[model samples]
Target: MVTPPSYESRQFERRPGIRPRQTLGRRLDAASRAALPAAIAVVLLLLLHAPLGLPAQPALLLGAELACVFYWSLFLPRVMPSPVVFVLGLLVDLLGTGPLGLSVVLLLIAHVAGIAWRQALMRQGALVIWLVFAGVAALCCLIEWLATMLLEWRLLPPGSAALQFGFALGEYLVLSGPFAWCMRVVARPHG
Candidate 1:
């Protein structure tokens, strides 16, 4: 009769590390999954550029930025990545009359900041998320104002940047709960 393996032998058995093994099929699947959100963001950005004259006025630009931030940071941070963020910002810069790298830098900064804060924010609920979004919007507006001042050598009128920033803040405030709920729905582990 054979004896059972000892506990020490079982304990020493080689086990895989935390990282999943990469395979061609898995990589392709990930790429495929990522395409949908990226394409949606691009199409939405283009539609925003279409000049349909949404009665909200100049806040439209702020709305676009808010959507980008929410999509890239909170929604699909891993799939979209930094290069996509930079490119999106570049497109915004080109579409708007702003300084060349303004949007690019702003988007990058915001994305990185969001990732850095993500862990702590994840522990909180919808209200905290809304507050974080407001903080991010305010920071982005400040950065945009500084860029404009440095590049254009002029300050925006009192209500100018504030209005735009308020629009962004409001967008986030209005949508944060729904977006968070959707994120949970989409992120549920499937088999």
Candidate 2:
């Protein structure tokens, strides 16, 4: 013979005196996941401004921020919408002493390109992906240089832009691995 569990044992209910509490972590978890990508972009942007003894000043791969935007845009376009991209660009502009809207425009362009290339990038090899990124970075650096010169009304040295492009490519090479890992962890199905 088998014994059935009592009703009280199987049917526990909260009394009026008991109330649900929302911890900070729980509250944050309740937020939409869409913010995750933008948050990462902000963190990466902050790291760029931090005193890491790395040459962030004077155009030492300003593409760090762009890299973050491009990576997320390419992999998970839905999570990172245009408004988030716009905010990230504003953050970059505020973090450094540069033209305010320059990053906004550049990041928006990267976002668009990444979205357009997402399908192709899915089937490409690592080298091809890196080459595509190199092209995007170069375009960003060139635009940045041209904008700076246009704003200042002077012919800024081209060498600086060239150096920035090289450093951007290097930044992509170093950061892409970690970015990919983060994407897997964050974007995985929550089942």
Candidate 3:
């Protein structure tokens, strides 16, 4: 019996352990992978303003986005550009009744600080990373408090500003795991 010509085609060849190809619609391309961090930033920003009925929800979400921005900016600068950070910060300012341009400046500074310390952070352990984050969050909170005071022409209680710093640090700890996982697994467009 002669095999049909179609039967002898390359498609007939079977590779062991490899499944048939499927649609790539579910897979993100390199550009999309690079944009994932920024996309996450947007989502977190939106959630920041959501009325979740929880006290300090806004602070928590802001902390989350700040952590997201810092991590991606440090590890994947292309994924989290300065403009995206600026926009998120702007949104925070717009959505809240805080001082205008305050978050924008803080976020931009955080993004820059992450970039500036990227190389050094890359070689460090989790402790060092956490310490550096603590410093950055502290500086940002301090700036925010000072800016608010200057804009309002009076001293406001530092409690909330200090709370913001605390939230940022806590969120960073919570988010670092997922961030690492995404960089190692989900963001790999090549595979």
Candidate 4:
């Protein structure tokens, strides 16, 4: 009589000594992956706020922050937690000499918006993602402009915020590919 296949003989069975838990090196790798977003934020802030002469410095800094925040929030929200976002925004505010909490509020709103949009898109193509990012970036710029005007109690020049938004869109488009590739490597589940 034919007997049932033994568990050890099954094709899908795991090999001996191979566990679901990763080795020490892999665990360290995963840890670094998790910390990458925060590290990148710190580095970006440092570079932007450095004393080097740069054109449109404030706008460039804001654009970089927005791109980094949006990319991480959309793809790897867990890696880019709210607290990290808050701290990054706070750093930008302190560095850029903007009103306290302005960047924080803007970043938090962007993070939420990104999460919502990512859910809707569900890993859709890059074009759709970029289109949605444009809308979100525009909204973020508006909110920031309104907040600045309200806090400072003065009307700002027209088209300033638009300029910032344009810079931010440029940053987003340029950085998305590199960030996406990094996320693919870092966010992958390790065995």
Top candidate (TM-score): 4
Give lDDT tens digits, candidate 4, residues 1-191: 99675333364355666555668997788688889988987898899888778777777787788889988988777788899999999988887777888899888887887777877776688888888888888888898889889988999975879989998899889988878777776654431
Clash pairs, candidate 1, are: none
Candidate 3 stretches greater than 4 Å from native: 1-28, 189-191
> How does residue 6 of candidate 2 score in lDDT?
32
Each prediction's Cα RMSD? 9.0, 11.2, 10.5, 8.2
Residue range 106-163, candidate 3, lDDT tens digits: 8887899899999899899998988988898889889978987898899899998889
lDDT of 2 at 15: 38
Ranking by lDDT: 4, 3, 2, 1
Residue 36 shift from truth in candidate 3, angstroms: 0.7
Q: Provide the lDDT at 167 for model 3.
A: 95
- For candidate 4, the per-residue lDDT at 77 reads 77
TM-score of each: 0.72, 0.78, 0.81, 0.83
Give me the overall lDDT of model 1.
0.66
lDDT of each: 0.66, 0.78, 0.80, 0.81
